[model samples]
Target: MKNTEVLEERITAQGCTEHLSAVEDAIYVIGGKWKLKIIIVLQENGNIRFNELQRNIPGISARVLSNELKDLELNGFVKRVVHAEQTPVVVEYISTDYSRTLQPVIMALSNWGKTHKRNIREDAF
Candidate 1:
């Protein structure tokens, strides 16, 4: 059987379409490493400039960040603003109303990760 067919069968067995859709949406948006990090940064800082975000997030190239931001903007999770000014003009990015909806989800994931890490460290003993 195909991968999607397997997934559909498993989803049906779970008996929760709502749960599956939520999981699917979460995966769709946070599938990439850069996307999750970018959302977290924007959540913490409110609005940030392009270079500032680049500096804050290590291992992300300008082109990669640009592409990620563009994707986020297209998906209604991020908004980009260009400042038209003389001498060293800037562009800033901020989370949108839709993005704010994910705040609780992000916090929950962060908390779970922290707890999991702590448990793993303890288990190493």
Candidate 2:
């Protein structure tokens, strides 16, 4: 092979490795079934209580929701606010500005999901 071709191949391989590493990091932070869903709900609702969040995403148990919230908070995608002045302490979860960066990704996934469902239905018939 030509020297130029070898150099191009090396660059391509390195690019692919970098891309894969970035994707892996993103997945590690937000790969779970409930994490994105939780973010979506929080973004839509602004600030919501724990019970409200659980209700918004059906099928998520309190334990799982709690765990996911903690993960999101740690990742800086979510803000947990506590209101102490109330007779009983009230806590709410809100999406951080940083989480807005995922809006495009979420939209892309939503569009792809719709298309996939339509294709599946057509194939079924």
Candidate 3:
């Protein structure tokens, strides 16, 4: 029996619904086209300013990044720090402790993506 065989096993309606609900909730939180991308960037870069973030994530507009950062901050996954003590105010965004909890999920998805691409390439040959 292979991993795919186990995946094909029939599940009960209640069990299916429960599993779907969990996935749906996950999608709701990290579902946006840019949420996970933003999280991954912040996690890797540590603390970065708005302009830097915009530059790091190609094709993302300032307006969209602003919205996503606001949402991440609101959700407590990212922290925004504003430094007004200097001549020019500075603002930086960093992932929160809670955000670290997502590392395993991101790594798992990354591994799956790599495997899926390899499988597709193999099937094409």
Candidate 4:
């Protein structure tokens, strides 16, 4: 089917719950181990290539990173740009306009994590 048809189908299917469910859906998009980390890294550093992402986020396997990046790109939160060059062509990942919707979600989670971390640290101390 065409892109417009798909979008219209989705809009028709989703109702008042769009806003509320969208927030939940956002979690599903960025909830993974590497996804949130990738977002945080990108938020700080701007666009990044595949290898750079894997390097910045230690302990994430190549396969896992590839899958996660693909998922992010598919979900409209991240975009993949392919540079048509010679060998070792550059591929960069950047956030999309739709991704701007994620900022408040990320900020809320950041605040929550900070508070939770402080509480845990204080308890340990």
Best by lDDT: 2
lDDT of 1 by residue, 4-115 (tens): 4245355454568788888898798777879989988898898899989999999999999999999999999999987878457778899988988988988998897997
Prediction-by-prediction clash tally: 0, 0, 0, 0
User: Model 2, residue 18: what's the lDDT?
Assistant: 97
The candidate 1 region of ten consecutive residues with least summed lDDT is 1-10
| Candidate with the larger TM-score of 3 and 4 | 3
TM-score of each: 0.80, 0.89, 0.88, 0.72
TM-score of 4: 0.72
Q: What is the lDDT of residue 99 in candidate 4?
A: 73
Question: Cα RMSD (Å) between model 3 and the true structure?
Answer: 2.5
Candidate 4: lDDT of 38?
75
lDDT of 4 by residue, 1-125 (tens): 12342443444445657877977876777786788787777766679988888899999999998898788788887888888885778888887777777788789888979978988898898
lDDT by residue (1-125, candidate 2, tens digit) is 12342443554788989989999999999998899999999999999999999999989999999999999999999999999999799999999999999999999999979978988898899
Candidates in descending lDDT order = 2, 3, 1, 4
Q: Give the poorly placed runs of model 3, Cα more than 4 Å off.
A: 1-11
Encode model 3's per-residue lDDT on 1-125: one tens digit a residue: 13753556778999999999999988888878888999999999999999998898999999999999888888889999989896699999999999899999999999989988998898899
The global Cα lDDT (0 to 1) of model 3 is 0.90
Off by over 4 Å in 4: 1-24
